[model samples]
Structures are given as structure tokens and as C-alpha cells.
Target chain A: MRLPKLFKRKASGEVAKDRLKILLISDRVNCSPEMLDLIKQDIARVISRYMMIDTENMEIQISKTGGYGIGSKNPSLYANIPILDLHKSS
Target chain B: MGEVIVITSGKGGVGKTTTTANVGTGLAAAGKKVVLIDTDIGLRNLDVVMGLENRIVYNLVDVVEGGCRVKQALIRDKRYPGLYLLPSAQTRDKSAVNESQMRKLVDQLREQFDYILLDCPAGIEQGFKNAIAGADRAIVVTTPEVSAIRDADRIIGLLEANSFQQIDLCINRMRYDMVKRGDMMTVEDVVDILSVNLLGVIPDDESVVVSTNQGEPLVGNHTLAGRAYRNVCMRLMGQDVPYMDLERSLSFWTRVTGIFHKSQEGRA
Candidate 1:
């Protein structure tokens, strides 16, 4: 178990890099983790008027995509909202 | 015409002032007329680092407020013939001077000096704004730690927002031993993460602290960090100097022993 644990552990440098990547993505979009929750709630309320969404399992994040460099990357909002049912318009 | 370059980092204690002093001294040693400005008001230490703290009769506030001429406020460095320092007012706050005043001062200095290095105060506050107001370029300094890198990213974003086109990065106090041991980040790791053009990397050396304490700049010394600062100054002048081989500082026996230790750890 100890040997397996050692293999599973990551170097501290790699950990710092991964952490900064995520932190910087959020920072660039100017959206905090708390703000992300508020956005999710607002989106859920609006989407629920036409279709039911699984708010409990919804995941929303602001990340950069399509570029490898710093200034070249573009910030994009990603949402994974599961649909429960589509309401028929009367 | 002289170039106004602001050395800034969002987080404090990342060696902005030291880099400013060393680079300014190096430029002066290279026969360029250089002036170092300490923009960190109410907590000024560039004078102390440059060993001119006792000679500051006029400061940035005095120059901007019409109390003294720009030449009167400039303190000539003791060692270098062409190096000078325009220190901040320790009694005043950042609000003592505005953006336009800083711009006007830099314009006046541009007619006389070859390089005007602004040692910016930490944080994205009014002091930071005043420091970059009249600058034509920027050098964002950072360390290997996560917090410093995060703040540096923020600083780069701010510089870009302010329409700064020629922004560079300088990694300071890097511990190659820790990096070899997988405990610290490498220069490549930092450059890849920040994605900025690298200026130079200063290795962590004890001589830096000693020089800072003695109120002397390190560019005149033979230390590793001193040589790194000289390389940074050369690059600032558009010289295509290659980076110093940090790993080559170690002996061949040390490298061989390091590999053996790593293999032993792998076996464990």
C-alpha cells in the first residue's frame, strides 16, 4: 500500500502548476467560485421555465480554451446541465 | 530619448527593488546614463538598498510638488558614475503624487538619461498606477512559488489592459537544487505558465542578502545573482545573450551522485 501510494503521489511542482492553471482561468474570467454558484442558480431558474434541468448535478465553470499560450487563450463559460424533461408550449 | 521601464510585481517581496537597483547599476556601468526611481511611497527602501538613504534631501514628492528641480531630487550613486536614484517620500503616502505629475517628471528625465528604471510598489493600487503611468515598457518579476506566480499573472493582465506592448518576465531567487529534487518549479515551467518572453533568471544566492544588507547593489559583485542581473541588463539593451548555465555550476561528481541517489530512492 505504501509503495502504491508513493507511485500515486505527484511532485509538488506539478501540483503547483495544475493549481495555478485552474486558479488563473477563474481569475482571467473575473468569476469567483461563489459567483459561479450564483450564475448556476440564475441559469437554472431561466431554463426551468421551458425545460427541467438537474440542478443538483449541474456543473458550470469558466475556463480558457483553444490556445496554449497565456494571452492567446480565450476565456469560455462551460456548463454541464442535465435535462430532465422538456415542457410543451401551450 | 530614454526608455522608462517599470519593474513591478503584484505581490510584495519578490525582489522588485533589488532588480531595479542592480539593473540600473549594470546599465550605468555599461556607460549608460541611468536613473532609478523608488515609487513605493511611505515605505521607501530603494535608497537604503542603493546606499543613498542618508543622502536623500529631495524626493519624488518634492520634485512633483514644485519644491525642487528634477536634478535636485536626483541622488547620484556612490559607486557608479552615471547611476542616480530618485527616492520616494517616506513621510507621504501614494496619494502625494498623481498620474500626470509622474508622466511630466518622466518626460523631463527622458531628455537627460538613457534609462529610467521605476521600482514600483507592490499591489495594484494608486502607487502601481503612478509607477506605470509614464513607462514605455514593463518587467514583471516573480518567484517560483505559487502565490507569486498567481500575482504575476494578474500583473501581466493589468499591464496588458493598460496597453503595455513590451512586457517581459524575470524569475528571481530560483533554487535549482529544489527543482532537481522535484520540489520546486523550473524556469521552463514558469515561462510556460506565464507565457511571457523571458528576460533572465537569478539563482538563489546568499550574496544577495548580504549585499542588500550592506546597502549595495549586486551588479558589481561576482556572485551568481549579480551576473544574472548583468545579463538581464544586457537583454534590456536588446543584446541576444544566452542564459547562464545554472546546472553547470555543479561538479561532475555531484551530478553522478545525484543520479545514484535518485536510483536508490526509486528502489525504495
Candidate 2:
């Protein structure tokens, strides 16, 4: 059994797959991908308040959502984000 | 019957040979009568990796072609009396043996051995199909790279379609320093992509290469990578062992030295 590089994602009914990953990464902090995306949006909204940033121009993409869902360990997330705080303008 | 397991990777040079060499040795060391078959055919390297190249009088082709008996082609490991190796035919093409012949050979081996380990060739060609045909289970070898994982996913889909449900993943060549620096994929990333149960993770310890080139099995030293192989062997035996922490294997000095070494290479 030779594994090729993983993730040629065919997420047909990706809800379960994506949700499982989301739970692992977030340690089940959020139950659903929709909830996680909303959290990203909410976090983005809160962070923008404390700094000079255009929330409209700010593009948010929470990607690589994955984690262990067996409940043996704490759920976690491996997400990538563009931190506007690092930007010179924001 | 002895369990038949195939170690394969979609991408070449991802340590399929090395994993077979070590894991087979680990099982053998554990007192299981193990046989490691090099199914790579024309691209055979398991013999060299296992340091039994000089002892190969008859190959898999020879057995399937009736030139020699299967027992005559099997090479017993010098280190482990219980371990044996069935080398591939370096001179023959993959066509020399088909899936049915392999199934027959494995079935025969099962009567005498406790485990049958097939070191499969790379790619999803006739060779790959032939390797998995007789496998009771398969260990998909892959590095934590985009291309390797993509091919692994393809292999998984193929295995599932073929009714080979007892499949697992062995992520090899994992570099902790790079993953710490956020430069490479984590175990989570690869497992996420493959969507299979994680069997084991072999770190990119140079000890493996030294052991491979020397035809000595890693189980002898119990190095990080060697221990990983042993742990995987346990898992294959139906134990639910959690994976070792790749981070804990390295101390602060080792990490610092590695970073400095990388910086030196960058400067050079």
C-alpha cells in the first residue's frame, strides 16, 4: 500500500469529512464547519475593531480545517489565516 | 493463516523499501516467522537494502517460472533466524509474475510463516495491482508532501474499490524541525488527506539510511525510526498504541543544532 500525496479532495457530501476535521482542530470547540467559519468571521470582526482596518477589503479564508475526532484527545485545528495585524496599514 | 501485508507508495523514493526492511525485521525479531518479499521486479532494491543481494540465487520470477522452488528462492536473514526474504528479479519485467501466481505463493508461505511482507514497487501500474492482489492488508507508505499524499489518496480509493479493507498509512521521512517551523505538513494534514487510520510515522532519521545502505535492520539499534517500525508492527498485531511524539524525540540542543545546520546550508 503506497500512499501518494494525500488530499485530492473529492468532498462529495463533504459535510461529514469537513466537520470531522473541524472538530479535531477546534477540539470540538465548534460543532460544525458553518460554526467554525462564523467563528472566523466573528474573530475577524472583533480584531478589526481594535485596529484601523477595512473589514470589507479584508479577505478571510480559514483553510486546512482538520483534527482527531475520536475524542481520545483534545480536538484541535490547523488553520491558516492572513493576520491583518501584520499589515502596515492595519 | 499468516497475514499478508504489502508496503507500497505511489511515489518512488519515499522509503517503501526501507519500511519493508525494518518492519519485516521488527516482526521477525519479535519471534514471528516472517518473510519479506521484494515485489519490485525490475527495480528490486529490498535485497540491497536488506544486504542479501549477494545471496540471491533465485528470484520471484524464477519461482513463478518454475526455474526454482519457492523455498529455494527464499533467503534467511542472518540477524534473525526466523526472518526470510524473497527477492525480486532484477532482470525480469513486472510481467514475469501475475496476481494469481503471487496469491498462490503467499498462500503457500502462510502455511509456514507467521507473516508475509511484500515490499511493493512504486506507481499504480501492473506491478502495484499485482502486489495488492494477494494482500490481506496493505501499508501505504508516503512522505508528508503534497504529491506523495495525492498519490496515496488515489491508492486508497483503488484499495477500497478492490475490497481490501484492511489498509493503513505509514507516513515516512517526517522532519520535525520543518514542521515546527511551519514549513511542512503535520501528521494531521496527511491523515486528513488520506482519511485512513494512521499506522505509524517514521521520522527522517539519517540512521535509517545508514542502516539501509549497510543491509542492517533498524530494529537492531531501536533508533527513533527503528522504534517507530516496531510500534507499527505492534499496531498491525491489533494493538491500539498511540503514535510517539515526533517533537519529544529531539532535545533542545538537537533542534538548535539542526537549525544551525540548516542555516549553514542556506549560507553555503
Candidate 3:
């Protein structure tokens, strides 16, 4: 019997690319992955106060846009928060 | 006026010195008046690499301190009529020279040479600061490994922060066979991650070791790395030279052996 695909190893090059993508993003923004998590939680808390949101599935990250040229890259925050319902304002 | 360029890498042992020596020699061989300034200070090695260690009478610190004339400290390469070296001080540390002093020295040399290549020391410290202080352009060198790539990214970010408009990347010691086997990152992968203009890619060749041991830059010879360095020099001169085709340059016997190895792996 063959082992499951999940047991197969990833190509080292692909692993390097994946690692660098996240590492570079963090390095560029001067924000650690743990710091990003805190920011994500804060965002979720603020959104939850106004609406019912899927905190478990919310995603937040800092990414770069614009040309890859030196001094041209612009870092911006991206968030994906799922909302199930809206709360009535008091 | 000559253009001042610094060859730097955040991490050590990534071929910054080798690239500086070869590129400087290559440019000189092309009939351009070039001066290579070793700014590593205290950990000086460029002099030995260029085989001019014994000729060093006065060093960078001496010139900066007014202990010697800038012209007096420069050691000319006998092999190239237009090539010279400003050796770093072996007895002093990075703090021996500061930013304005470096700017002044480079400014002085600018009127004389056609190109000024600064071989920057490793790390982002006083030495690094002094190296980039006088540079108009920066060439960041890196290997395909994760540590080197991470450091390169950091260096690029630092260079961008310094308002450098002409930063380029040189990927060194690339192993084509490993890249073909999916064991190493390709040049495209590195370029995509670094996001800097590709200056050139040097293959991992044993001849580079031989050349360095002989105190010679590989630009004059016909080795793979030598050819790559020549292409880099051409690119620096604003010539449109295509990147070397490493795959096609492989020997037929090596290609056949590669196929046989792949078949063995398939059977497993």
C-alpha cells in the first residue's frame, strides 16, 4: 500500500519560497507573526462589538503592492473577516 | 565623474569579496579606470584576495586620519594598468572611519577613476554604514539559501530606506544541478522573492576556489564563474548581455548521468 500524499515531503525549493514570502512580509513591516496575531485579535474584537463575526476564520496580514523596485513597494494591511449577523445599535 | 558602487551582502560568506574583486578586475580589463576600496576594516581580506597585501603601505584609516595622502595609500595592480586598491586598515576597527570622511575620500577618488567599487564588510554595522556612505549605487549579493536570502531582503529594505534608487541583486554560487532536481531554488525564485533587478548569476564552480587561492580574480579565465563575472561587468557598462544558459552549458556526459539518476529515483 502507498503512503498518503500528506506523508510526502514538499520540495525544498517550494518550502523556501513559502517561508521567504511570510518572512519577507514580516521583515518589511517590522512586525512579528505574534504581533500580527494580536492585531488580528484586536480587529476581531472591534468588529464583534458591532456584528456577529467568525473570529475563528478571520484572516489578517500585511502585504506589499506596487512595483517590486527598490523604494517603490507599498505595504498595506489586508483583513478577511466573515460576518454572520449584525447587532442593533443601542 | 566616476560612479561609486558598493558590493554588499548583509550576511558573510556570500561571495561579496569575490564579486567585488572580479567585477573590479573585469571592468579594468575592459579599459575602464577602476579603484576598489576595501572598507571591511580590522578584518581586511581584499588586499590578500587581490595579491596586493604586501604592497600596502598606508591604509584607509591612515588616509582618513590625514596620516597619508589618498594617492599614496592606493596600490596599483600591475596586471591591469588602470586598476588600483585602497586597502582597509588591519589594526583598526570599523569606528576608525566615519560617514563624512568616507564621502570625502570617495569624492576625491571620483575625479580620477572611471569606476569606484567598494567592497563592503559583512553585517549592518559601522563598517556597513561607512561603505554605503559614498556609494551612488549598490549591488546586493546573496546565495539561494534561506539565511542568505533573508539577509538580502533585510539589506534591500535597509538600502531602500536609505533612498538608493539603483539597487541590484547578484545571486552567487548557484547550483544548477540541484536546482534542476528541485532541491535548490532557481534564479527566478530568488529574483521573485528579492524583487530586485537581476545583475547576474554565478554558478558554483570549483575553479573559483583555485582562482581565489592563487590570488587572482576569475574574470580573465574562461571558467563558468569567470564568464558570469564578465557578463556582470558588461551589464554594469549598460550593455545588454543575456544571462548565461547554465542548462545548455552542462556536459553531455553529465546530462546522461542525470537521466540515469532520475530513472533510478523513479524506480524507488
Model 3 chain B poorest 10 in a row by lDDT: B259-268
Encode model 1's per-residue lDDT on B159-268: one tens digit a residue: 98898888899999999888876778889889887888899999998989999999988784556787789889899999999987888756676557546654654311
How well is each residue in B1-268 modelled by candidate 2, as lDDT tens digits? 7999998888899988888988888788777999999999898899988899899899999998899999999998888899999999988898888999988888999999999999988899989988998898889998977667666766776787687767789999999887765556778877775667889999999888788778887763446776688788888878787887779777776566546654664311
Choose the strongest candidate by TM-score.
Answer: 3
Q: What is the C-alpha RMSD of each candidate to the true structure, in Å?
A: 7.2, 13.0, 6.7
Q: Each candidate's interface RMSD, rounded to one decimal? A: 2.1, 10.9, 0.9
Give the DockQ of candidate 3.
0.76
The residue-by-residue lDDT of candidate 3 on B76-110, one tens digit each, is: 99789899999999988999899999999999999
Clashing residue pairs in candidate 1 are: none
Write down the TM-score of every candidate.
Answer: 0.84, 0.71, 0.91
Rank order (by DockQ, best first): 3, 1, 2
* Docking category of candidate 3: medium
For model 1 the TM-score comes to: 0.84
Local distance difference test, each candidate:
0.89, 0.77, 0.89
Model 2, span A5-84: residue lDDT tens = 22443322233335434333332232565776686678667776665455555544333334532222333444344455
User: Over all chains combined, what TM-score does candidate 2 have?
Assistant: 0.71
